[model samples]
Target: MSSVTIEARHEAWPLREAFVISRGAKTAADVVVVEAIDGAHRGRGEAVPYARYGETVEGVIETIRSAAVHISSHADLTRFLKPGAALNALDCAFWDLESKRTGIAVSARAGLPHPIAKITAFTLSLDTPSVMAEKAARVPHLSLLKLKLGGTGDDLRMQAVRQARPDAHLLVDANEAWTTETIGAFLTAAVECDIELIEQPLPAGHDDILADIPHPVPLCADESVHTADNIETLLGRYDAVNVKLDKAGGLTGAMRLVAEARRHGLKIMIGSMVATSLAAAPAMLLAPYADWIDLDGPLLLARDREHGLHIENGIIQPPDPQLWG
Candidate 1:
């Protein structure tokens, strides 16, 4: 094992300038990258601004800096970190570093045969019905599209995208924007559109309404399902769960979530924040068991760190660890 030193850095990217979302994100993209260096090997990981988690680039940098002293002293990746953006980045960097050191793949480290690249959902950020339809039509070889839903009239948006791309699989992410009354109408439209899944329509604490609602699309728990401890309460409410390494805190929590979610028959979706490729690489281990994939973090970025994961069309390839440990 090589002695590793870790450092964290932040970068800002300007959006297309006109791009905006219901979440009020309009011009800038900021992310924090964690780098772990050992001898000639360097591994990297990045995390985005998780609005739900109150994470800014500076906050994540501060969080990682607080742990740098502890992480640099520990050689074991698994025991070195906790979960969240800071730990997620560092944990992934450690995995990348170890993979390079051992001359084996990340799948081999986790006892899997090989990393199988799978079709992922291309996201259509919140936009006008016509604009979203146009965006959806442009994505090539895309079987799945995750539509960001949180506007006044999602039925029109959903119908427009569906009409535009009748052959593509569709899913909706409301980002905790639905009310009890609007959910029925929203779901009705999704059912008519033949949507496959709906994620976190209602806010977490008020999601009890889902228990009685008859949803045509399978419901996926995103904000509702964080760590392994959440699976029990989430059993009857959601048909699937979105597992992001950031929310799970690190690989240790994510592995536990996969087992616990399966024990309850909840379908798994390995998701990620709008991070660089480095952040999504480590979570690729969960790909084998996931029913859905949303590792499109780097795809959303203007440019990724060097030697990032390869993405072609909608399929995400395995990571090249030369960029991060």
Candidate 2:
């Protein structure tokens, strides 16, 4: 194996507008891009550092830089770094580089079938009920819509969106904002509005509440579940798990998590943080295992990288080779 050279940089992609969720709002997506090169072939990957997990762009970049010196192979990377944004970028880049060097598609390398286009759930950022409804109305062509919900007035927000897009499938993500005391009313409204799924309705530690109550709508775990290690604990509480490449560390860890989640009879929802297509491409490979797909991160940006994933009428086509793997 040839010695690999690594390059890492930070990028701030401007969002078309501020994207708000239960936590807060941001006008730009701060991402770390990593490239691994061996001989002439190059593979690239991107990751968004999440502050909720105590990650900063500077911290993530430094972490990658520190590990890059010893990472001559993809397998070495897995042992060198823990699961997080930093390792996600490096791990994905290694996969991409390997695919390019071997002249093989990532799907084939991962022992998966060729990726087919699928309908992705476009997200409506958290806002007033009227505003969210208006936003949902603007994207009537989309069949599935993911709504970001905060604690208060969640009922009104769901009702408003359902009224606007009566035919659309609905998924709600609370992003660890709700408390045990208030989740009942929220779940009540969610079911009343015919929500397809509710994601992370309450914070991680408080997920025990889910086991106590009858889930009117199937609940999916996002912030509460990261990798396969989290699957066993979430079995009774969550009906599904949202696997994002960033959270699982990369495609390798994500595939493991998906298999583990399935073994426990839990549904899978492949999700993404607010990043570019480079980040979404690897996550897209996991869509076949997911019941709900939310790789609409690039669609939310003001501009995406060249050769980005093509999303027409909410159906995301497979990533072009130039985009990543």
TM-score, cand. 1 vs. native = 0.91
Predicted structure 1: lDDT: 0.79
Write down the TM-score of every candidate: 0.91, 0.99
What is the per-residue lDDT of model 1 for residues 1-325, given as tens digits with 9 covering 90 to 100? 5457889998775544333445665455577777788998776667665777787778888877777766663244446455677777777676666677678776778675477788888888888899999999988578899999884889999999999999999988998888898998898898999999999998988999788867678999998988899998886789999999888876657888988999999999999876667677777767888899998767777677678888887888776656543
* Candidate 1: worst-modelled 10 consecutive residues by lDDT: 13-22
Instruction: Give the whole-model CA lDDT for all candidates, comma-separated.
Output: 0.79, 0.92
lDDT of 2 by residue, 29-69 (tens): 89999999998999998999979999999999999999988
C-alpha positional error of residue 110 in candidate 1 after TM-score superposition, expressed in Å: 2.0
Top candidate by TM-score: 2
Please list all clashing residue pairs in model 1, or write none if there are none.
43-324, 43-325, 44-324, 83-249, 84-249, 93-325, 96-325, 97-325
